[model samples]
Target chain A: MRLTSWGNLSLDDYQTFFYDFNPNLLAKIPKPVIAVGASRSYGDVGLNHLGSNLLTTNLNRFINLDGNLVTAQAGINFAELEKVLNLHKLSLPVRPGTSYLTLGGAVANDIHGKNHHLQGSFGCHIKSMRIWRSDSGVIEISTQREPDLFFATIGGIGLTGLIIDVTFEATEFLGNQIKVENLVFSNLSEFNQINQSSQNYETSVSWVNISGKKNGNGIYSRGNTVPEFAKKITKAPISYPKNLKLNFINSTSIKIFNNLYQNLQKSIKISLVPAGKYYFPLDGVNNWNQVYGAKGFYQYQSVVPEKNAYEVTEEMLNLMKEEKTYSFLTVLKSFGDKSSGGLLSFPMAGLTFAIDLQNQGEATLKLMNQFDQIIQRAGGRVYLAKDARMSREFFESSYPNYEKFNSLRDPYFSSDLSRRLLGF
Target chain B: MSKILVIGSTSGIANEAIKIWLEQGNHIHLYARNHDKLKMQVADLEIRFPGHKIDAFTFEANNLSKTLDQISLDNFDIALITVGELKYSDELVGQIQVSEKLINSNIQIPLAFAQTILEKYKTQGYGKLGIIGSVAGDRGRGKNYLYGASKAFWETYLEGARQEIWKNKNISLSLIKPGPTNTAMVQGRELGNLRLAKPEAVAKVIVNGMERGKSVIYAPKIFQLIMFIFKIMPIKIFNRLSF
Candidate 1:
């Protein structure tokens, strides 16, 4: 079967095997097996070129849901988890941008969301996990027991082992709606000022227009949980549509869409929205990535320290303008001083900018390489979850702790990302 | 609330049917081969519908009779069977082995198990039993005779059983003949011109047919007409047509 990342880049042919919650099946599988859950990663991190992928979607099941802690098989996506949690009036401490990702996928990537400044990445909420190592038998790893392996498995990108079940803490919420307030920012400087002032809000994010016309113009939004006394909120029906055919997106159409979006932001300055609508806007459109066309697109995200964030972001935006290249979606968010624990985790105290540009083949690759150079000089690293073409030299330079993470990886567990970056 | 028993509970179509039944506040007893997966599914249902009662048992489809003997059929309102596999081979010897496995899984186990439930339901004078049949059974093909033969056997057996069960007016049976459905069992195989139905879509037809007391119905409704023409085609002309 053919497998591709969310970015629709790096297509690789691979055979997949399914396990029905049986651990012994691991021994029968070929060596160098990579476990795939949802394949939500935007790059080759989830694709194994040398061996088959063990699909964990069938292994989804809840082990337990006691009080605030929910223990479930790694195959269950947050959408299902959230459905159950809503009945108990609880929510995941750190919800990813999309709930389509399986629990194991979220852990492997140590995903972060709009509330990263307050809640940290997904790995922080993970209390323990049961892993099936290729050589070693099934064993439980947690912050206390086998801490090093547990830490490595969390953002280790499935290089550690197959995560069977995970136990994590859930936060209690009043309702599943957010009262949002949108503010328009003329430049990156004003966006930073608003972000600093809105420290009390539970969620904060901005969408910037990198095109030459709009330049730094964007919408900055902050939201908090809707209070109980507020008028009853209606949840929009959740639907997943089939991916649209190619040729759905082009540069001209995107420019018009961005302009319309900017204009709409001015009208909808304040409104109440469902949590799903606010947290996972992309989930509503299902296969929305196909809009980028058959060649797909690349999402380049990097986090630079607070001191150099402004200069680095300005230089990157200026480069895009100079090249007359524009990104369809430009997200700018701030990270807190939370420790992700995983050695290769991407979040840190800094300003992170994630931009999605349609793939123009070699030109797109060349532009990403140039962006990597700027990020490297700023002492920052690209997010592994969103990277499709980061160089090995830059990967090593960005993640200096690669040696430590590599030392703990399962001998037989590897991915295309590891093969390209670590020569595994 | 209806008391439903679903065999091969983890199969694609069965799972979807189970979800709809559970959503309607029915109490379900599930039986499948994978113990842990069934437990997870049961837990998921219990969480989603806390008011309804849900239980699960793990049993190999080939040995379903033995497992059914252990569980009492008393108080069950309906039983749905969705257990079978596709097997193929060009060599006669290999084909025989595949045929035997298919017969054991698709015909013997389901018939024996359903007979046991029907015997009990007949005495009680009120109950429903649904057996999943296949359109492939309408005619044997050079490509998948092994699988088609087993389904043909099951459909024939149900046709005979329906006559006896109808003697007791309150007892009901449904022979659900679903067309080519997109499922893991059919993965990689060329489905030819047959419209591939989604599992959920097929499940809806099965449940709705059971509610309407449909004895022998082709799922998707359109397949009924298609199969009507297919069944009338003379053997000489049918054998010449290739999927």
Candidate 2:
């Protein structure tokens, strides 16, 4: 089967095995395999190009739900989990931009969301997990038991083992509606000020215009779950036609789209939106990446410490301007001080910027390398989940705990990312 | 709320169908071959649909008679039989054990279970029954004719049973003929360009058709026409074509 990350980059053929509800099946699958859930990661972190890719989507099933705590199989995506939680008037403490991400993916990536400032990354809420390792066999781990392995596995990028199931705490929510407020920031400085002011809000993020025409100018939005109950609405996603061969997204179109989006949001100060629409707007347009063309796109997400955040971001924007590169979607947000237990966790107390650059092939790669240099100098690390291209030296430097995580990795399990960065 | 009995409840299609029925406020009774798997499935269903009644029983084919005898079927308003096995082999004569297992799983066991359910439904005076057959049953193909032949037996058996219950307005039976569905049964098969229907979608159609009292249903609805075309094709042309 041909597999690619959510970025649609690094497409390659792989021998795939579906994870049926049996641990013994793991032993049968030829190793150096990686377990993939939804393959929502933007890079090759979920891709096992050299070996088998264990598709865990079929492993989806709820194990138990007691009050606010929920235990479920690794393959159960947040979209399904949210629906079940909504039934009990509960909401996930932390959720990524897209609900299509499976629990295993979330834990592996240690994903952060709009509520990161208050709730921290997804791994923070995880109570325990059952993982199947080729070297160690099936074992259960948590903070109280095998703490080192437990922490390493949290953001271990599926190299630690294949997560079987996870138990997590879900917080209570009043309703399915979010009262959202959009505010505009003229620059990175202004955006930081506004972000600080909106810290009380449960969710906060900004869509920056990285075309360099406006530098750091963007729309900053903050939202919180409204107290009043609203009926859950489900609209069938519109899928992009597979046969369409043309790329509709370009620098010209991206600029036009960004300007139009900003202008449209200028008038909308506050409104009530469904949680799904607020959290996963892109999900409403299935295969939205197809618009980027067959060449696909690269999502570069990096987090820098708070002190260097402004300077590093300004340098990145200037670099993009110098290179004449345009990003279709540029998201900027802040991470809270609450650190995750995952040794290789991406989120830290810093400001993070994620931009989707159209694959201009060599030009894009060169530009990304420049951004990587700026980030590395500022003591920042590119998110492995969204990185398709990053040097091994930079990876080791960025994640000081990399050696420890490497020591704990399941020898029989490997991924394109691990092979590229760790040389396994 | 109605009581629903689902045999082979752990199968992908049956599990999905049971979820739909449960969501519609139906209490479910599950029966599967694996005790541990059945327990896990029951726990999963219980967690997903809290406050709903869910009971499960595990039984092997040989002890199926004793298992059926132990559980009362009078309360179940609907019964869905989704048990079957699919084995592909070109060397039929040499693989006696494989052939026997396929026959026992796909034909004998399901037929016996269906007979027991039909008899109970007749005695209960009012009940709905759905048995999952396959599109392959319309005409045996070279790839999996043994499995196809077993389904053909179901087509004939259901046809006769439909006739028996035609006069009884309270009793109904539906033979669900699903095309290639993306389930564990067809997971590893080389489906070529054939698009497998989602088990959830197939289950929805099956449950809906059974509720509406349809005698026969081809899930995805496209299979009915495809099967008709195949059924009318000349033997020479059919022989030349390979799946």
Q: State every prediction's TM-score relative to the real structure.
A: 0.88, 0.95
TM-score of chain B of each: 0.90, 0.95
- How far off is model 1, as Cα RMSD? 3.9
lDDT, candidate 1, A1-424, per-residue tens: 5678888887656766655466676666666778888988888888887766776775566778888888988987888888777777788788777888999999999999899888888998999999988778788999899999999998988899889999999999677778999998888889888999988899999998765364677889999997553443445555434454556566677778888888888789898887877888767766777777667788888999888898899898888887778666889999887866998898988999998878898888888899999999999989998887899999999888899999999887888888988779
Q: What is candidate 2's lDDT per residue for A111-141, written digit by digit as tens? A: 9898898999999999989998877778999
lDDT of 1 at B45: 68
List of clashing residue pairs for candidate 2: none
Q: What is the DockQ of candidate 2?
A: 0.42
lDDT of 2 by residue, B1-243 (tens): 888889899998999999999999998889899898788898888777878889898888886778677555355789899989887758476999989988988887787778888888888788898988899888888888998888888777888988888888988888899998777775433343456687889999999999988888999888889999999999999999978
Q: How high is the CA lDDT of each candidate model?
A: 0.81, 0.86
Cα misplacement distance, residue A224 of candidate 1 (Å): 0.7
Backbone collision tally, model 1: 0
- List ranges where model 1 is wrong by over 4 Å: A29-31, A212-214, A229-248, B10-12, B32-41, B56-73, B83-103, B134-147, B165-171, B177-202, B215-243
What is the lDDT, from 0 to 100, of the residue B214 in candidate 2? 88
